[model samples]
Target: MAKHYALASYADGGDWRETEHLYVPRRDTRLRLQSLMALGYTASEVAAATGLSPSHVCNLRTDVVHTTVHVFTADAVASAFRDRWDKLATGPQANRQRSKARRLGYLLPLEWEPGDVDTDDTTEMFLSDPSSPETTENPEVLDYVAIAEAIAGRRVTLTRAELSHAIVTLQDMGVGVHETAERLHTYTRLVNRYRARARQDAA
Candidate 1:
Protein backbone atom coordinates (compact mmCIF):
# COMPACT_ATOMS: atom_id res chain seq x y z
CA MET A 1 0.00 0.00 0.00
CA ALA A 2 1.19 3.53 -0.72
CA LYS A 3 0.23 6.86 0.75
CA HIS A 4 -2.05 9.01 -1.39
CA TYR A 5 -2.36 12.81 -1.60
CA ALA A 6 -5.12 14.95 -2.99
CA LEU A 7 -4.21 17.61 -5.57
CA ALA A 8 -5.93 20.72 -6.88
CA SER A 9 -5.13 23.77 -8.91
CA TYR A 10 -5.28 27.15 -7.23
CA ALA A 11 -6.00 30.60 -8.67
CA ASP A 12 -2.27 31.01 -9.32
CA GLY A 13 -2.48 27.99 -11.67
CA GLY A 14 -0.29 25.85 -9.52
CA ASP A 15 -1.20 22.37 -8.37
CA TRP A 16 -0.96 22.06 -4.59
CA ARG A 17 -1.31 19.10 -2.31
CA GLU A 18 -4.52 18.72 -0.31
CA THR A 19 -2.48 19.13 2.85
CA GLU A 20 -1.86 22.73 1.87
CA HIS A 21 -5.60 23.48 1.92
CA LEU A 22 -6.30 22.11 5.36
CA TYR A 23 -8.16 24.43 7.74
CA VAL A 24 -6.06 26.08 10.39
CA PRO A 25 -6.80 27.63 13.76
CA ARG A 26 -8.30 31.07 13.16
CA ARG A 27 -7.51 32.87 16.44
CA ASP A 28 -4.81 35.07 14.96
CA THR A 29 -6.79 35.71 11.78
CA ARG A 30 -9.86 36.72 13.77
CA LEU A 31 -7.80 39.07 15.94
CA ARG A 32 -6.22 40.63 12.90
CA LEU A 33 -9.65 41.27 11.38
CA GLN A 34 -10.94 42.75 14.63
CA SER A 35 -7.89 44.96 14.99
CA LEU A 36 -8.39 46.30 11.48
CA MET A 37 -12.01 47.06 12.29
CA ALA A 38 -10.94 48.77 15.50
CA LEU A 39 -8.65 50.96 13.43
CA GLY A 40 -11.81 52.04 11.52
CA TYR A 41 -11.68 49.75 8.47
CA THR A 42 -15.14 48.60 7.52
CA ALA A 43 -15.88 44.98 6.63
CA SER A 44 -16.59 46.10 3.07
CA GLU A 45 -13.15 47.68 2.79
CA VAL A 46 -11.48 44.52 4.02
CA ALA A 47 -13.63 42.36 1.76
CA ALA A 48 -12.65 44.50 -1.21
CA ALA A 49 -8.98 44.06 -0.39
CA THR A 50 -9.15 40.30 0.30
CA GLY A 51 -11.82 39.14 -2.17
CA LEU A 52 -13.94 37.87 0.75
CA SER A 53 -17.58 38.77 1.12
CA PRO A 54 -18.36 41.69 3.43
CA SER A 55 -20.64 39.50 5.53
CA HIS A 56 -17.92 36.89 5.86
CA VAL A 57 -15.47 39.51 7.12
CA CYS A 58 -18.07 40.76 9.62
CA ASN A 59 -18.65 37.24 10.87
CA LEU A 60 -14.93 36.67 11.33
CA ARG A 61 -14.75 39.88 13.32
CA THR A 62 -17.74 39.15 15.60
CA ASP A 63 -18.01 35.37 15.80
CA VAL A 64 -15.99 33.56 18.45
CA VAL A 65 -17.45 30.06 18.44
CA HIS A 66 -15.86 29.08 15.13
CA THR A 67 -12.33 27.94 15.90
CA THR A 68 -10.93 27.26 12.44
CA VAL A 69 -10.92 28.69 8.93
CA HIS A 70 -9.71 27.74 5.47
CA VAL A 71 -5.99 28.36 4.96
CA PHE A 72 -6.63 30.55 1.96
CA THR A 73 -9.20 32.59 3.86
CA ALA A 74 -6.71 33.13 6.65
CA ASP A 75 -4.01 34.12 4.20
CA ALA A 76 -6.26 36.68 2.51
CA VAL A 77 -7.17 38.27 5.84
CA ALA A 78 -3.55 38.31 6.95
CA SER A 79 -2.46 40.05 3.76
CA ALA A 80 -5.21 42.68 4.12
CA PHE A 81 -4.39 43.27 7.77
CA ARG A 82 -0.68 43.69 7.09
CA ASP A 83 -1.41 46.33 4.49
CA ARG A 84 -3.86 48.32 6.67
CA TRP A 85 -3.00 47.82 10.34
CA ASP A 86 -1.42 51.23 10.81
CA LYS A 87 -3.82 53.28 8.71
CA LEU A 88 -6.86 54.94 10.25
CA ALA A 89 -9.86 54.52 7.98
CA THR A 90 -12.17 57.51 7.35
CA GLY A 91 -15.75 58.23 6.16
CA PRO A 92 -19.10 57.43 7.72
CA GLN A 93 -18.88 53.68 7.21
CA ALA A 94 -15.42 53.53 8.73
CA ASN A 95 -16.61 55.55 11.73
CA ARG A 96 -19.51 53.15 12.23
CA GLN A 97 -17.20 50.15 11.98
CA ARG A 98 -14.83 51.59 14.60
CA SER A 99 -17.73 52.38 16.94
CA LYS A 100 -19.07 48.83 16.65
CA ALA A 101 -15.65 47.32 17.31
CA ARG A 102 -15.20 49.56 20.35
CA ARG A 103 -18.63 48.60 21.71
CA LEU A 104 -17.70 44.94 21.25
CA GLY A 105 -14.40 45.45 23.12
CA TYR A 106 -12.15 44.39 20.27
CA LEU A 107 -8.40 45.02 20.72
CA LEU A 108 -6.80 47.96 18.88
CA PRO A 109 -3.79 47.65 16.56
CA LEU A 110 -1.67 49.47 19.11
CA GLU A 111 -2.49 46.76 21.64
CA TRP A 112 -0.44 44.09 19.87
CA GLU A 113 2.58 43.74 17.63
CA PRO A 114 2.78 41.43 14.60
CA GLY A 115 4.09 38.53 16.67
CA ASP A 116 1.79 39.25 19.63
CA VAL A 117 -1.51 38.62 17.85
CA ASP A 118 -1.24 34.84 18.23
CA THR A 119 -0.18 34.83 21.85
CA ASP A 120 -2.44 34.40 24.85
CA ASP A 121 -0.60 37.09 26.81
CA THR A 122 -1.25 39.90 24.35
CA THR A 123 -4.03 41.44 26.47
CA GLU A 124 -1.61 41.76 29.36
CA MET A 125 0.97 43.34 27.07
CA PHE A 126 -1.63 45.84 25.85
CA LEU A 127 -2.35 46.97 29.38
CA SER A 128 1.33 47.80 29.79
CA ASP A 129 1.63 49.96 26.67
CA PRO A 130 1.56 53.53 27.92
CA SER A 131 0.78 54.93 24.50
CA SER A 132 -2.34 52.77 24.17
CA PRO A 133 -5.67 54.65 24.29
CA GLU A 134 -6.90 52.13 26.86
CA THR A 135 -4.30 53.43 29.29
CA THR A 136 -5.38 57.06 29.06
CA GLU A 137 -6.99 58.00 32.37
CA ASN A 138 -7.80 61.60 31.58
CA PRO A 139 -8.61 61.84 27.91
CA GLU A 140 -9.27 65.40 26.76
CA VAL A 141 -12.91 66.35 27.11
CA LEU A 142 -14.27 68.74 24.47
CA ASP A 143 -16.21 71.81 25.64
CA TYR A 144 -19.77 71.04 24.70
CA VAL A 145 -21.33 74.13 26.29
CA ALA A 146 -19.07 76.48 24.39
CA ILE A 147 -19.87 74.64 21.19
CA ALA A 148 -23.61 74.86 21.91
CA GLU A 149 -23.44 78.60 22.59
CA ALA A 150 -21.40 79.17 19.45
CA ILE A 151 -24.13 77.44 17.48
CA ALA A 152 -27.18 78.87 19.32
CA GLY A 153 -26.49 82.65 18.99
CA ARG A 154 -26.17 82.80 22.78
CA ARG A 155 -23.48 84.87 24.43
CA VAL A 156 -20.45 82.66 24.89
CA THR A 157 -18.19 83.23 27.91
CA LEU A 158 -15.52 80.68 27.05
CA THR A 159 -11.89 81.77 26.69
CA ARG A 160 -10.40 82.25 23.22
CA ALA A 161 -8.60 78.91 23.44
CA GLU A 162 -11.74 77.12 24.60
CA LEU A 163 -13.85 78.62 21.80
CA SER A 164 -11.23 77.70 19.22
CA HIS A 165 -11.09 74.15 20.59
CA ALA A 166 -14.88 73.85 20.34
CA ILE A 167 -14.85 74.96 16.70
CA VAL A 168 -12.10 72.51 15.85
CA THR A 169 -13.95 69.71 17.62
CA LEU A 170 -17.05 70.39 15.55
CA GLN A 171 -14.95 70.48 12.39
CA ASP A 172 -13.36 67.17 13.31
CA MET A 173 -16.82 65.69 13.78
CA GLY A 174 -17.58 66.58 10.13
CA VAL A 175 -19.78 69.56 10.87
CA GLY A 176 -19.30 72.28 8.26
CA VAL A 177 -19.49 76.04 8.73
CA HIS A 178 -22.92 76.31 7.14
CA GLU A 179 -24.37 73.74 9.52
CA THR A 180 -22.70 75.30 12.50
CA ALA A 181 -24.01 78.75 11.58
CA GLU A 182 -27.50 77.40 10.90
CA ARG A 183 -27.55 75.71 14.26
CA LEU A 184 -26.30 78.83 16.02
CA HIS A 185 -28.88 81.03 14.25
CA THR A 186 -26.02 83.20 13.15
CA TYR A 187 -24.36 84.11 9.86
CA THR A 188 -21.72 81.85 8.29
CA ARG A 189 -19.26 84.76 8.66
CA LEU A 190 -19.09 84.22 12.42
CA VAL A 191 -18.58 80.46 12.01
CA ASN A 192 -15.94 81.10 9.36
CA ARG A 193 -14.05 83.44 11.66
CA TYR A 194 -13.99 80.79 14.38
CA ARG A 195 -12.91 78.17 11.85
CA ALA A 196 -10.12 80.39 10.60
CA ARG A 197 -8.87 81.00 14.15
CA ALA A 198 -9.01 77.29 14.90
CA ARG A 199 -7.01 76.47 11.78
CA GLN A 200 -4.43 79.11 12.59
CA ASP A 201 -3.94 77.81 16.13
CA ALA A 202 -3.73 74.24 14.84
CA ALA A 203 -1.04 75.16 12.34
Candidate 2:
Protein backbone atom coordinates (compact mmCIF):
# COMPACT_ATOMS: atom_id res chain seq x y z
CA MET A 1 0.00 0.00 0.00
CA ALA A 2 1.17 3.59 -0.66
CA LYS A 3 2.32 5.24 2.55
CA HIS A 4 0.50 8.33 3.73
CA TYR A 5 2.12 11.26 5.52
CA ALA A 6 0.34 14.16 7.19
CA LEU A 7 2.06 17.50 6.76
CA ALA A 8 0.60 20.50 8.49
CA SER A 9 1.51 24.19 8.30
CA TYR A 10 1.65 26.78 11.03
CA ALA A 11 1.39 30.56 10.87
CA ASP A 12 4.79 31.07 12.41
CA GLY A 13 7.71 28.87 11.29
CA GLY A 14 9.32 26.61 13.87
CA ASP A 15 11.92 23.90 14.19
CA TRP A 16 11.19 20.56 12.46
CA ARG A 17 11.81 18.91 15.84
CA GLU A 18 8.66 20.69 17.02
CA THR A 19 6.68 19.00 14.22
CA GLU A 20 5.84 15.40 13.25
CA HIS A 21 7.20 15.81 9.67
CA LEU A 22 10.21 13.51 9.60
CA TYR A 23 11.50 10.26 8.05
CA VAL A 24 9.56 6.99 8.50
CA PRO A 25 10.62 4.25 6.03
CA ARG A 26 8.56 2.50 3.15
CA ARG A 27 8.92 0.63 -0.20
CA ASP A 28 6.99 3.20 -2.25
CA THR A 29 9.28 6.01 -1.02
CA ARG A 30 12.37 4.09 -2.16
CA LEU A 31 10.86 3.46 -5.60
CA ARG A 32 9.86 7.11 -5.96
CA LEU A 33 13.39 8.33 -5.11
CA GLN A 34 15.01 5.78 -7.42
CA SER A 35 12.75 6.78 -10.31
CA LEU A 36 13.70 10.44 -9.95
CA MET A 37 17.42 9.56 -9.80
CA ALA A 38 17.11 7.56 -13.04
CA LEU A 39 16.19 10.81 -14.77
CA GLY A 40 19.75 12.25 -14.32
CA TYR A 41 19.37 14.33 -11.14
CA THR A 42 21.96 13.67 -8.48
CA ALA A 43 20.65 13.13 -4.95
CA SER A 44 22.54 16.23 -3.83
CA GLU A 45 21.03 18.28 -6.65
CA VAL A 46 17.52 17.07 -5.92
CA ALA A 47 18.06 17.55 -2.21
CA ALA A 48 19.17 21.16 -2.75
CA ALA A 49 16.23 21.81 -5.04
CA THR A 50 13.73 20.21 -2.66
CA GLY A 51 15.04 21.70 0.62
CA LEU A 52 16.04 18.19 1.77
CA SER A 53 19.40 17.03 3.01
CA PRO A 54 21.46 14.88 0.64
CA SER A 55 21.41 12.10 3.23
CA HIS A 56 17.61 12.18 3.25
CA VAL A 57 17.56 11.85 -0.52
CA CYS A 58 20.16 9.07 -0.52
CA ASN A 59 18.42 7.10 2.23
CA LEU A 60 15.15 7.27 0.27
CA ARG A 61 16.97 5.55 -2.64
CA THR A 62 18.03 2.62 -0.44
CA ASP A 63 15.90 2.85 2.68
CA VAL A 64 12.11 3.08 2.88
CA VAL A 65 12.31 6.41 4.75
CA HIS A 66 8.99 8.25 4.82
CA THR A 67 7.39 10.91 6.96
CA THR A 68 4.91 13.72 7.35
CA VAL A 69 7.09 16.62 6.24
CA HIS A 70 6.26 20.32 6.14
CA VAL A 71 4.03 21.42 3.27
CA PHE A 72 6.65 23.96 2.13
CA THR A 73 9.26 21.19 1.91
CA ALA A 74 6.86 18.90 0.06
CA ASP A 75 6.02 21.74 -2.33
CA ALA A 76 9.71 22.32 -3.07
CA VAL A 77 10.21 18.61 -3.83
CA ALA A 78 7.08 18.56 -6.00
CA SER A 79 8.32 21.59 -7.93
CA ALA A 80 11.72 19.96 -8.56
CA PHE A 81 10.11 16.73 -9.71
CA ARG A 82 7.77 18.57 -12.08
CA ASP A 83 10.62 20.49 -13.72
CA ARG A 84 12.79 17.39 -14.18
CA TRP A 85 9.89 15.22 -15.37
CA ASP A 86 8.82 17.78 -17.95
CA LYS A 87 12.39 18.27 -19.14
CA LEU A 88 13.39 14.58 -19.40
CA ALA A 89 10.22 12.50 -19.68
CA THR A 90 10.19 10.08 -22.68
CA GLY A 91 6.61 8.80 -22.93
CA PRO A 92 2.88 9.61 -22.81
CA GLN A 93 2.64 8.44 -19.18
CA ALA A 94 5.22 10.99 -18.13
CA ASN A 95 3.51 13.72 -20.16
CA ARG A 96 0.15 12.98 -18.57
CA GLN A 97 1.67 12.89 -15.11
CA ARG A 98 3.49 16.17 -15.73
CA SER A 99 0.30 17.81 -16.95
CA LYS A 100 -1.55 16.72 -13.81
CA ALA A 101 1.25 17.97 -11.59
CA ARG A 102 1.30 21.31 -13.46
CA ARG A 103 -2.44 21.74 -12.87
CA LEU A 104 -1.68 21.24 -9.19
CA GLY A 105 0.68 24.29 -9.44
CA TYR A 106 4.01 22.50 -9.97
CA LEU A 107 4.93 24.58 -12.98
CA LEU A 108 8.03 23.92 -15.10
CA PRO A 109 10.86 26.45 -15.07
CA LEU A 110 10.95 29.05 -17.84
CA GLU A 111 14.54 28.48 -18.97
CA TRP A 112 15.17 27.13 -22.48
CA GLU A 113 17.22 23.95 -22.76
CA PRO A 114 18.74 23.42 -26.22
CA GLY A 115 20.54 20.13 -25.49
CA ASP A 116 17.87 17.66 -24.43
CA VAL A 117 14.11 17.96 -24.97
CA ASP A 118 11.66 15.18 -24.12
CA THR A 119 8.61 17.00 -25.52
CA ASP A 120 7.27 16.43 -29.09
CA ASP A 121 7.84 18.14 -32.46
CA THR A 122 5.38 20.90 -31.66
CA THR A 123 7.63 22.03 -28.81
CA GLU A 124 10.54 22.07 -31.26
CA MET A 125 8.56 24.18 -33.72
CA PHE A 126 7.73 26.62 -30.94
CA LEU A 127 11.35 26.87 -29.82
CA SER A 128 12.66 27.25 -33.37
CA ASP A 129 10.23 30.06 -34.19
CA PRO A 130 11.12 33.56 -33.06
CA SER A 131 8.75 34.51 -30.29
CA SER A 132 6.58 37.62 -30.77
CA PRO A 133 3.47 38.87 -29.04
CA GLU A 134 0.29 37.74 -30.87
CA THR A 135 -1.07 41.25 -30.55
CA THR A 136 0.83 44.48 -29.79
CA GLU A 137 -1.69 46.43 -27.72
CA ASN A 138 -4.39 45.16 -25.43
CA PRO A 139 -7.99 45.91 -26.47
CA GLU A 140 -8.93 49.46 -25.46
CA VAL A 141 -10.23 49.46 -21.93
CA LEU A 142 -11.03 52.22 -19.46
CA ASP A 143 -7.86 53.30 -17.63
CA TYR A 144 -9.26 53.36 -14.11
CA VAL A 145 -6.04 54.67 -12.59
CA ALA A 146 -5.62 57.39 -15.21
CA ILE A 147 -9.12 58.74 -14.63
CA ALA A 148 -8.92 58.48 -10.82
CA GLU A 149 -5.43 60.00 -10.51
CA ALA A 150 -6.27 62.84 -12.94
CA ILE A 151 -8.99 63.98 -10.53
CA ALA A 152 -7.01 63.14 -7.35
CA GLY A 153 -3.86 64.99 -8.50
CA ARG A 154 -0.43 63.40 -9.24
CA ARG A 155 0.20 60.43 -6.96
CA VAL A 156 2.36 60.80 -3.88
CA THR A 157 4.54 57.83 -2.89
CA LEU A 158 4.35 56.64 0.74
CA THR A 159 5.85 53.68 2.54
CA ARG A 160 3.42 51.16 4.05
CA ALA A 161 4.15 52.50 7.55
CA GLU A 162 3.56 56.07 6.38
CA LEU A 163 0.28 55.05 4.75
CA SER A 164 -0.87 53.34 7.94
CA HIS A 165 0.08 56.43 9.93
CA ALA A 166 -1.92 58.63 7.55
CA ILE A 167 -5.00 56.45 8.00
CA VAL A 168 -4.76 56.59 11.77
CA THR A 169 -4.13 60.37 11.75
CA LEU A 170 -7.22 60.91 9.63
CA GLN A 171 -9.29 58.81 12.02
CA ASP A 172 -7.99 60.92 14.96
CA MET A 173 -10.00 63.88 13.52
CA GLY A 174 -13.25 61.84 14.05
CA VAL A 175 -13.64 60.75 10.39
CA GLY A 176 -15.84 57.64 9.90
CA VAL A 177 -13.48 54.67 10.18
CA HIS A 178 -15.14 52.66 7.38
CA GLU A 179 -15.13 55.55 4.93
CA THR A 180 -11.52 56.42 5.70
CA ALA A 181 -10.47 52.81 5.12
CA GLU A 182 -12.36 52.64 1.84
CA ARG A 183 -10.86 55.90 0.57
CA LEU A 184 -7.33 54.84 1.56
CA HIS A 185 -7.77 51.50 -0.14
CA THR A 186 -8.98 53.14 -3.35
CA TYR A 187 -6.16 55.70 -3.29
CA THR A 188 -3.42 53.08 -2.77
CA ARG A 189 -4.87 50.76 -5.41
CA LEU A 190 -4.96 53.49 -8.03
CA VAL A 191 -1.47 54.73 -7.17
CA ASN A 192 -0.12 51.19 -7.45
CA ARG A 193 -1.84 50.68 -10.80
CA TYR A 194 -0.27 53.85 -12.25
CA ARG A 195 3.18 52.91 -10.89
CA ALA A 196 2.91 49.43 -12.40
CA ARG A 197 1.94 50.84 -15.78
CA ALA A 198 4.83 53.31 -15.67
CA ARG A 199 7.27 50.47 -14.95
CA GLN A 200 5.82 48.37 -17.75
CA ASP A 201 6.14 51.19 -20.24
CA ALA A 202 9.72 51.85 -19.13
CA ALA A 203 10.56 48.18 -19.56
Candidate 3:
Protein backbone atom coordinates (compact mmCIF):
# COMPACT_ATOMS: atom_id res chain seq x y z
CA MET A 1 0.00 0.00 0.00
CA ALA A 2 1.18 3.59 -0.77
CA LYS A 3 0.45 6.77 1.22
CA HIS A 4 0.01 10.31 -0.03
CA TYR A 5 0.35 13.78 1.52
CA ALA A 6 -2.00 16.71 1.22
CA LEU A 7 -0.92 19.36 -1.32
CA ALA A 8 -2.18 22.73 -2.40
CA SER A 9 -4.71 22.58 -5.23
CA TYR A 10 -4.60 24.81 -8.30
CA ALA A 11 -7.71 25.90 -10.19
CA ASP A 12 -6.28 24.78 -13.52
CA GLY A 13 -5.19 21.41 -12.08
CA GLY A 14 -1.70 21.81 -13.46
CA ASP A 15 0.41 22.64 -10.44
CA TRP A 16 0.29 23.45 -6.76
CA ARG A 17 -0.92 26.97 -5.90
CA GLU A 18 1.86 29.45 -5.29
CA THR A 19 1.34 30.54 -1.69
CA GLU A 20 2.88 33.55 -0.08
CA HIS A 21 2.59 34.71 3.50
CA LEU A 22 3.57 37.89 5.34
CA TYR A 23 5.00 37.53 8.82
CA VAL A 24 5.27 40.67 10.87
CA PRO A 25 6.96 39.85 14.12
CA ARG A 26 5.80 41.19 17.47
CA ARG A 27 9.15 42.95 17.91
CA ASP A 28 8.72 44.76 14.60
CA THR A 29 5.27 46.05 15.55
CA ARG A 30 6.46 47.19 18.96
CA LEU A 31 9.39 49.05 17.47
CA ARG A 32 7.15 50.69 14.87
CA LEU A 33 4.70 51.74 17.61
CA GLN A 34 7.49 53.28 19.68
CA SER A 35 8.84 55.09 16.63
CA LEU A 36 5.42 56.61 15.92
CA MET A 37 5.01 57.56 19.58
CA ALA A 38 8.36 59.30 19.56
CA LEU A 39 7.09 61.20 16.53
CA GLY A 40 4.29 62.55 18.82
CA TYR A 41 1.52 60.06 18.18
CA THR A 42 -0.78 59.19 21.06
CA ALA A 43 -1.74 55.64 21.95
CA SER A 44 -5.27 56.17 20.74
CA GLU A 45 -4.09 57.31 17.33
CA VAL A 46 -1.74 54.37 17.00
CA ALA A 47 -4.50 52.01 18.09
CA ALA A 48 -6.86 53.42 15.51
CA ALA A 49 -4.28 53.04 12.79
CA THR A 50 -3.28 49.53 13.88
CA GLY A 51 -6.85 48.33 14.37
CA LEU A 52 -6.07 47.56 17.99
CA SER A 53 -7.50 49.03 21.18
CA PRO A 54 -5.70 51.85 22.97
CA SER A 55 -4.77 49.60 25.87
CA HIS A 56 -3.51 46.98 23.48
CA VAL A 57 -1.33 49.47 21.74
CA CYS A 58 0.02 50.72 25.04
CA ASN A 59 0.75 47.20 26.23
CA LEU A 60 2.57 46.37 23.04
CA ARG A 61 4.59 49.54 23.29
CA THR A 62 5.58 49.07 26.92
CA ASP A 63 5.77 45.32 27.29
CA VAL A 64 8.21 42.89 25.69
CA VAL A 65 6.62 40.18 23.61
CA HIS A 66 8.40 37.76 21.30
CA THR A 67 6.23 36.31 18.62
CA THR A 68 5.89 36.37 14.86
CA VAL A 69 2.54 36.05 13.13
CA HIS A 70 1.61 35.80 9.49
CA VAL A 71 -0.72 38.69 8.74
CA PHE A 72 -0.88 42.19 7.33
CA THR A 73 -2.17 44.11 10.34
CA ALA A 74 1.17 45.40 11.57
CA ASP A 75 2.49 46.17 8.10
CA ALA A 76 -0.67 48.06 7.27
CA VAL A 77 -0.41 50.15 10.41
CA ALA A 78 3.22 50.98 9.72
CA SER A 79 2.41 51.95 6.14
CA ALA A 80 -0.35 54.26 7.28
CA PHE A 81 1.91 55.91 9.84
CA ARG A 82 4.65 56.42 7.24
CA ASP A 83 2.22 57.98 4.75
CA ARG A 84 0.96 60.47 7.33
CA TRP A 85 4.39 61.38 8.64
CA ASP A 86 5.81 61.78 5.13
CA LYS A 87 3.03 64.21 4.27
CA LEU A 88 3.80 66.24 7.39
CA ALA A 89 7.51 66.25 6.66
CA THR A 90 7.39 67.34 2.99
CA GLY A 91 6.11 69.93 0.53
CA PRO A 92 4.70 73.14 2.05
CA GLN A 93 4.89 71.80 5.59
CA ALA A 94 8.61 71.08 5.30
CA ASN A 95 9.19 74.53 3.87
CA ARG A 96 7.24 76.02 6.76
CA GLN A 97 9.49 74.19 9.19
CA ARG A 98 12.54 75.70 7.52
CA SER A 99 10.98 79.15 7.63
CA LYS A 100 10.25 78.81 11.35
CA ALA A 101 13.80 77.65 12.00
CA ARG A 102 15.25 80.55 10.06
CA ARG A 103 13.08 83.01 11.95
CA LEU A 104 14.41 81.55 15.18
CA GLY A 105 18.00 81.82 13.93
CA TYR A 106 18.53 78.06 14.11
CA LEU A 107 19.62 78.23 10.48
CA LEU A 108 21.61 81.09 9.02
CA PRO A 109 21.16 82.73 5.64
CA LEU A 110 24.07 83.06 3.21
CA GLU A 111 25.35 86.63 3.36
CA TRP A 112 28.37 87.90 1.50
CA GLU A 113 30.06 91.12 0.54
CA PRO A 114 30.04 92.43 -3.07
CA GLY A 115 33.53 90.98 -3.63
CA ASP A 116 32.33 87.41 -2.96
CA VAL A 117 32.55 84.90 -5.85
CA ASP A 118 29.49 83.81 -7.86
CA THR A 119 26.91 82.20 -5.53
CA ASP A 120 25.67 79.80 -8.17
CA ASP A 121 29.13 78.21 -8.56
CA THR A 122 29.55 78.00 -4.77
CA THR A 123 26.05 76.54 -4.29
CA GLU A 124 26.61 73.93 -6.96
CA MET A 125 29.94 72.97 -5.46
CA PHE A 126 28.49 72.54 -1.98
CA LEU A 127 25.08 71.01 -2.76
CA SER A 128 25.43 68.83 -5.81
CA ASP A 129 27.00 65.37 -5.63
CA PRO A 130 27.09 63.69 -9.02
CA SER A 131 27.09 60.19 -7.46
CA SER A 132 23.98 60.74 -5.40
CA PRO A 133 20.52 59.72 -6.57
CA GLU A 134 18.10 62.50 -7.58
CA THR A 135 15.30 60.92 -5.57
CA THR A 136 16.89 61.95 -2.25
CA GLU A 137 15.65 65.48 -2.87
CA ASN A 138 12.05 64.25 -2.89
CA PRO A 139 10.37 64.16 0.52
CA GLU A 140 8.12 61.23 -0.39
CA VAL A 141 11.16 59.10 -1.08
CA LEU A 142 12.76 60.26 2.13
CA ASP A 143 9.65 59.21 4.02
CA TYR A 144 9.85 55.71 2.60
CA VAL A 145 13.49 55.56 3.61
CA ALA A 146 12.63 56.81 7.07
CA ILE A 147 10.13 53.97 7.44
CA ALA A 148 12.88 51.45 6.78
CA GLU A 149 15.13 53.23 9.28
CA ALA A 150 12.44 53.24 11.95
CA ILE A 151 11.96 49.50 11.51
CA ALA A 152 15.67 49.01 12.10
CA GLY A 153 15.33 50.84 15.47
CA ARG A 154 16.71 54.18 14.28
CA ARG A 155 13.79 56.57 14.29
CA VAL A 156 15.04 59.26 11.93
CA THR A 157 12.52 61.80 10.57
CA LEU A 158 14.40 64.36 8.50
CA THR A 159 14.10 65.57 4.94
CA ARG A 160 17.11 65.60 2.61
CA ALA A 161 17.90 69.27 3.27
CA GLU A 162 17.56 68.87 7.00
CA LEU A 163 19.76 65.77 6.93
CA SER A 164 22.41 67.63 4.95
CA HIS A 165 22.39 70.44 7.49
CA ALA A 166 22.61 67.93 10.30
CA ILE A 167 25.63 66.25 8.72
CA VAL A 168 27.40 69.59 8.34
CA THR A 169 26.52 70.53 11.89
CA LEU A 170 27.89 67.23 13.14
CA GLN A 171 31.10 67.73 11.21
CA ASP A 172 31.43 71.22 12.71
CA MET A 173 30.86 69.69 16.12
CA GLY A 174 34.04 67.60 15.61
CA VAL A 175 32.49 64.46 14.16
CA GLY A 176 34.75 62.83 11.59
CA VAL A 177 33.94 63.49 7.92
CA HIS A 178 34.47 59.83 7.02
CA GLU A 179 32.05 58.76 9.76
CA THR A 180 29.35 61.12 8.57
CA ALA A 181 29.78 60.10 4.95
CA GLU A 182 29.62 56.43 5.89
CA ARG A 183 26.36 56.88 7.75
CA LEU A 184 24.92 58.90 4.90
CA HIS A 185 25.89 56.18 2.46
CA THR A 186 24.11 53.57 4.58
CA TYR A 187 20.95 55.67 4.51
CA THR A 188 21.22 56.13 0.76
CA ARG A 189 21.26 52.38 0.29
CA LEU A 190 18.20 52.03 2.50
CA VAL A 191 16.33 54.65 0.50
CA ASN A 192 17.25 52.96 -2.77
CA ARG A 193 16.08 49.58 -1.52
CA TYR A 194 12.79 51.03 -0.29
CA ARG A 195 12.14 52.72 -3.61
CA ALA A 196 12.72 49.45 -5.40
CA ARG A 197 10.31 47.68 -3.06
CA ALA A 198 7.70 50.38 -3.65
CA ARG A 199 7.92 49.89 -7.42
CA GLN A 200 7.62 46.13 -7.09
CA ASP A 201 4.63 46.49 -4.78
CA ALA A 202 2.93 48.85 -7.17
CA ALA A 203 3.44 46.48 -10.05
Best by lDDT: 1
Order the numbered candidates by TM-score, best leading. Answer: 1, 3, 2
Per-candidate count of clashing residue pairs (backbone under 3 Å):
2, 4, 0
* Span of 10 residues, lowest total lDDT, candidate 2: 8-17
Scored against the true structure, residue 198 in model 1 reaches a CA lDDT of 60
Looking at candidate 1, the ten consecutive residues that score lowest on lDDT are 4-13
Order of quality (lDDT): 1, 3, 2
lDDT per residue as tens, model 1, 110-164: 5565565554332333334332344323335646676677645464544334544
lDDT per model vs. reference:
0.63, 0.42, 0.44
Global lDDT of model 2? 0.42
Screening candidate 1 with a backbone cut-off below 3 angstroms (N, C-alpha, C), the clashing residue pairs are 151-184, 152-184
lDDT by residue for model 3 over 134-196, one digit each (tens)? 324654444555544533335366665445544544445565544543444322332343344
lDDT of 2 by residue, 139-171 (tens): 244344443442233333433333333444444
In model 2, the Cα lDDT at residue 97 comes to 46
Give the number of the best model, judged by TM-score: 1
